[model samples]
Target: MKPLNITYIYDYANLQVEEVRGSNISLKNRLAKLEQALRNKDELAENLHVIDFEQLKIENQQLNEKIEERNEELHKLRKKTIVTVQIITHMREKVQFVQKEYQILKEELAQLDQDLGAQRDLVTKTKHERDEHRQEYASLKQQTGIMNSEHLTKDFKDRAERIKELKELITQLKKRHSQMSQFIKSHGGVI
Candidate 1:
């Protein structure tokens, strides 16, 4: 069927109304004209239905395009959310690693402090021992000095007594030799 044209139908209806206004028409001609108008009206009604159906199809297509656009946006959002979650998980892992390293360093620092304290204690004990040794050495030196002076005085006295005894023995030997020489001369024995 040919598509209905509104301008053509308006012109055709005006032409028919002008013809009907001439009231000298026969009954058969009027009946024929009414039947033709009725047929045009039914064709117009069918054409309006077709136009409405075409408009609904266009609107349906436009709605589908909007839904597609929204779906694409939703897909992009889901991808972005996944990437953000991955970044957050990586950051959490890094924070945990840093915390573990900090704990290890803290323990090492504590151990170092303990070692330093022990070294200080050892130094203090060594200083005390050194002081005690120095005092003992001083006391021993004073006692040794006194003992050496007494020994020297006793040796000098013993040497002076021995020299006196040797001088008396030499005088006795000289007196005996002079007496023997005089006796030989008095006896006339090769004096």
Candidate 2:
């Protein structure tokens, strides 16, 4: 009654040990499958990171090109502004020169006007003197005409009588001249 049989106990213990070993093997296989899945996930993440980095680099290049284009446009605008300013300055100078020339021309015109006024005065004086001389000549002609009329009236009839008497005298003078001519010829003088 005090000593139990140990052979049956040993057989039961052996059966339990076999079951524990089988369970341990199944757990190890499951852990191996989980590790392989983790490795695949890590590779997928690395590929996505590379794609994101490439996209970022392309966007940066595009932005840099746009900036360069804007800078070139700004430079052209600056050059155009400078040219416009220079043109404005040249125009201003030309306007000032024209103003000065206009002033000079105005002065010259004023002097010409004064000279013309003086010439006009001389012409007026000459015309007045000519008129006075014409009046004086007309007065002298009138006086001469009056004197001729008076002398003609005084001697008109007497001169006619004297012309008749002188005609008879001219006959006698012709007879005497003929006698004198014959006498001069006989005397050998120039007849």
Candidate 3:
């Protein structure tokens, strides 16, 4: 049926019913008009249902569009989540690499500490040996002073031999220190 203004028909029906309630019009004529107005209002109401059906179609189309837009947004979010997961994986690898490097550095530091302890011990031993050599030299000097020329000459020879031995020991120590320096260089360590 063709669409028409339903409110106008409804209002006309209401006017007729009101007029019939208090007017001096003949009862039969008023009753006929009243019945015709009611029929017109019913027809208008049926036409109004077509408008409501069109509005419902528009509303359904809008809801479908909204659902499609929401689906597109969800896809974008899913892609972003995947990218975030990749970044997190790369960062995790970096953290593991750093941890391995740190562990290696820690081990090297421990080795250096042990070497330091050994060096300290060597320094202590060298000091004690120096003190003993000093005491021996002092004793020889006193003996030379108290003895005759022949005995003094013998003491001088003994002192010369001891000096040669000390020189040899110093040479050995220098070679040992050189070897240690080479070892440090090979291991990427500074002496």
Candidate 4:
């Protein structure tokens, strides 16, 4: 080996110093990129927190509206219940009044039935008496034909005139009974 050259060694030492400076600059660029990335992440997290708070506020407002609607519905239902109860009470009173009226009408009908029965009995008794009077008049007429003397004939004529008057009275009684029957029929009696 020959002796080392001083100029060559000086050139090699300068080359090594330039390479160290380049490496230090590259490392500084990488550190700056990392710092920028960290700042961007912090900004994103802050924006997300603000969005979540806004969403929570909106949900709270919706819940409050639903509660108010339910309270209004409950108040309306309570008013309707009170009105319904009052109507039922009025209907019950009306029913009681109608029942009382019906009972009074039933009692009146029973009394009318009793009156009609008495009237029918009176009509039947009057008919029986008229039939007995007719039989007696027939017997007296037969006896009058058996008499021959003038005095007896005169007495028989007078008795015959009396019987005719009695027949007229019986006819009038029959007319009155017919009028009473018509009256009872027109007044809703079961004659």
Candidate 5:
């Protein structure tokens, strides 16, 4: 019986040792799988970091382009404003010049109107004087013609009276001559 007990105890001890060895092999396989999973997680984290960095760079470039476009638009607006101001100033100067010219022309026109009025007055006076002179000349001519007619009538009457006187003297001379001739014929009978 002691020998059989010793054999049974040795068989139980061997079985227990074999069970512990199987548990150790299973633990080693689980640890190897955990190490491989940790390595894969590290690789995935590195790829995500790179992707995030590229996305931030693209967003920064887009923001820069938008800022540049806004600056360009602002510059164009400033240039246009300057040009408009210059044009407005030029137009103002032209308007001022035109106004000055118009004022000068108006003054000149007023002076011309005054001159024309004076000239018209002078012409009217001269015409009145000319009409008076013409009337006077016509009156003088009529008066001269009347005086000449009166003088001619007086000369005709004087000539008619002188002719009558000469005829009477001739009649008296003939009578005297006839008497003298008869006396001489009677007294000279025998001389």
Candidate 6:
């Protein structure tokens, strides 16, 4: 974990780095002016050279430290940005995976819907076929009943006609039998 002080240091370093950059430009100008003075061998330039050189060295060292500190902060920030980018890439991949799964589920649902429709059609067709078969069976049953009834009626009529004829024949035979018996009685011989 980064210490909280590092955040303060980074902020301070950023401000100092900008100040040091501006100081560096001034330092360059002063150095240039010092060079010009030294070439002319000015007496005052000779007397203040050590003090000014020492002061320049101290400022240069401070500026270098500030630059180094700012570079360190930038390095940390770069690493954090890289990690953030990686995390973002991972999230994007997860989203794509979920999307693919969703597409597959949608396709499966569509197929199931089609299957359901087909099954419903099959059920309807089966019911229709079953009804047709029932109707055919009922028609055949009705025809069979009519044939049976007609046969029964014809048999009853034939039986009744035969019974009437037999009754007539029996009456005629009884009359003949009575006549024969009377004739025999009338011809009664005592001999």
Q: Which stretches of candidate 2 lie over 4 Å from their true place?
A: 1-66, 144-191
Candidate 4 lDDT tens digits, 83-148? 989999999999999999999989999999999899889889988888888998888877877664
Q: lDDT tens digits, residues 1-191, model 3?
A: 87877888899888988887657457767888999998998888778778878888899999999999999999999999999999999999999999999999999999999999999999999999999999998888788776646887899999999999999999999999999999999989965
Candidate 1 achieves a global lDDT of 0.87
**lDDT at position 169, candidate 5:** 84
Error of 5 at 121 (Å): 1.6
Answer with 1 or 3, whichever has the higher lDDT. 3
- In order, candidate lDDTs are 0.87, 0.88, 0.90, 0.87, 0.86, 0.91
Candidate 5 Cα deviation (angstroms), residue 184: 56
> What's the TM-score of each model vs. the native?
0.36, 0.40, 0.42, 0.39, 0.37, 0.37
- Model 5 Cα shift for residue 37 (angstroms): 20
Give candidate 4 misplaced runs (Cα > 4 Å). Answer: 1-52, 123-191
Q: Which stretches of candidate 5 lie over 4 Å from their true place?
A: 1-67, 134-191
Instruction: Compose the digit string of candidate 6's lDDT tens values, residues 28-77.
Output: 99999989877777667765787799999999999999999999999999
* Candidate order, TM-score descending: 3, 2, 4, 5, 6, 1
Q: Single out the weakest 10-residue window by summed lDDT for candidate 5.
A: 1-10
Please give the distance, in angstroms, between residue 129's alpha carbon in candidate 6 and its true position after superposition.
13
> Superposing all C-alpha atoms, what RMSD in Å does each candidate have to the true structure?
18.9, 13.4, 25.8, 22.4, 18.6, 28.2
| lDDT, candidate 2, 1-191, per-residue tens | 76866776777777777777677777777777788877887787688778878888898899999999999999999999999999999999999999999999999999999999999999999999999999998888788886657678678878999999999999999999999999999989964
- Tell me, by TM-score, which candidate is best: 3
- Model 1, range 43-90, lDDT digits (tens) per residue? 996898799889989999999999999999999999999999999999
